[model samples]
Target: ADVDYWSGCLAPDKLAARITPATQALVAANANGHPAAWNELRTLASQHGLLLIEDSSEAIGSTYRGRVVGSFGDCAILDFTQPGPLSCSQGALVLTDDIDLASKLRLLRNRRLSDRGSVVAGGLPVADAGIGELNAALGLAQWTRLDDILARRKAVEAHYLKVIQSFEGIKPPYVAPDVDEVHWFLSLVHLGTRFSRGSRDDIVDDLHTAGVEAAAYCLPLHRQARYFDNQRPSQDLWVTDKLADRALALPFHAHLDAEEVEFIVQTAKDASINVGAGSAIYL
Candidate 1:
């Protein structure tokens, strides 16, 4: 089975413009990367009878080309784990317009019609045999608050960009021209050539020592342990690997205050300088 995921900007638009008639499906994930571009890709895919799978795991409140990301594909997936805007203890969901597919997904989760052929507890099942009613209830409640959560997270991301841009060696991650909103799972700053002197690691370690937890946003999916033996040629991911090394994400949450944001920025600036200076050697 061959799959294509959209992560790079130029490539997505290019792929959307041109594809072999043999291509099967086009999959897209990542928050607010570029849905219009993906839409074009989807239309092209449909022209050739290909499936579109949208991953809105990091894009719950994000929009693409004025439509929601989850609304565009044959099937969509959303993560409910920590780091998402509406995170919970566990669970992920798939959404689709097809009733048959929905029924199949329910069956996949182990839900089945009761053999007794009678409704129990006023149309509620006596035995779940799958996801429990309580889990559904919890998710429903969380869904109700998604708007507020996304709003707060967007605000936080905006403030971060505002402050980080003022410091040297920090620039917000790439957001395509067409994206109206960003559901930032992590706020990104490029370490750039400043990393050549080792500033990136110094900044990362400084944040850790200062009680501000931060990390590299992602590793190329092809580099994971399971894929190592069968990894695609390294040249396929020139940009992805570059991002993997030089991008750093700082502590980002709704609860953080302006003072905290300032501190994080200042600390990062110091660390970047230290890395550029090299080895902290005294003259």
Candidate 2:
């Protein structure tokens, strides 16, 4: 399921090839604030008569073809977590126009007191997924100023971009042509081919040694311990694995000022140089 090295979204062709008689729904994410190929995905879903579940948790304000990410799929989900733009401590909101599906989802999440005896259950277990009143209030309050929140994060992104451009081997943010806007979930600096996974780790270690926090962007799902299976034939995801090895995530938040941004970038550059990867960048 891991697809591209760049935007980190699903590949429609790969997804389509994997579809079988048992395939129920198609899930896609506007990963790291970059919109997925919704047009292609929509067509694939329609052709297969499958439901599309859009994951807009990291891309709350990102837009694709002028339409917001959450506005694309049959139903979408928004998370109010710390990493997300809006945080209510913790909870998620699922969006759907289907009343029946909503009702089912609500039932699955939590059985209302009024519905316990009123409705019949087929031995379904309740997850107790109800959001507390305080959390709900907080989420609603933050929702009203969502635009301002996104704008502030965008400003931080600008700072990071401006700083990273001067650092050797790293390019600015990558945005697709069709994407109208991007609201980055994290400040990312992609290491080119000249740096190996170990060198990337060395860079991160150096940053940490300098009291700067940084991290590898992600470990692909298929490579994770839980999902790794030798019996199952490996799907080709060279790009995903390679990108996972190369991508670096730095401290990113609306609170970071220009000076802090410069320090972070400079630290990364110094780290890259220490690892013998600063000059010979694989552009």
Candidate 3:
């Protein structure tokens, strides 16, 4: 699950709490190519004797410490969703050096109910059609085009950064120093305390009215009614909570042209102005 940036009207800090060594299973957010954060998290997991599981669905081409994100943890999982480089329809992959975990996953995801031997062959079998042929074809095609796709996505993100950075009140997501490649899935703009003009909702609506689809990004998971009821929170997250309130995701795709990017930027700036001091805003 994704970490929530906000809870109870407060911004949560990006730093997770230091757990005792008794903790066994560790799950981490995939910060694209941010080596320091990853390094800190890796050390924490190592200290705790925990198996770090990275949700690398958003970091396909990102690197950490000169190694790719998928290689960072004990196990990493990737999703072939719409924004993913490997997307065709839907797919998931798990990567690990641990042979035991790999073998277990294979059996769990693709096991047959029918017995391997003659004595226990009475149960019904579960069959996956696409897992055999369609999945293989999709995988091969995506693998072949992975590099080119990543480059295209990077170009789009660079365009977004160039345009958005020129605007007065929007800050793009941070990219750490050592990240060699980032397979951008979304173009995020943070409206922090510095932005005096408008709220995130206002900006999102303004973009939408101009035919640019935009949205507030992640909500803090801790504040969700279902999750909060069951688990007591351990720390105060000042940064993440603020991010949940102010972060906006603009439309980004490899197919978008420079003209389109310009339009988005112009619209966003206009929206920011409109929302300042209640000038005018549909949202």
lDDT accuracy of residue 262 in candidate 2: 91
**Residue 170 alpha-carbon offset, candidate 3, angstroms:** 2.2
Candidate 3: give its CA RMSD in angstroms.
5.4
| Ten-residue stretch with the least lDDT total in model 1 | 1-10
Cα lDDT tens digits, model 2, 1-283, are 6576567889888899889999999999888899999999999999999999999998888988879878888899988887778999988988888898888788778877877677556566778797889999999998999999888888888888777878776655788888999998888778876898998998999999999989988887777766665544445877777778888999987788889999999988888887864356654
Q: Could you estimate the TM-score for every candidate? A: 0.81, 0.92, 0.81
Residue 183 of model 2, lDDT score: 92
Over the full model, what C-alpha lDDT does candidate 2 score relative to the true structure? 0.84
Candidate scoring better on TM-score of 1 and 2: 2
Q: Which stretches in model 3 have alpha-carbon errors above 4 Å?
A: 1-16, 32-36, 113-136, 194-198, 277-283
| Alpha-carbon runs more than 4 Å astray in model 1 | 1-10, 13-23, 32-36, 113-135, 196-199, 277-283
Model 2 weakest 10-residue run by lDDT = 226-235
Model 1 agreement with the true structure over 1-283: per-residue lDDT tens digits: 1122223433555455545777777776654333435656677667778887787777777776687778877889887777777666567788999998777676566534574475334333333334456666777797998888777877787778778876664434565666776677776666655464245666788888887787766666777877788865566566666666677778877777778888887887776776664332211
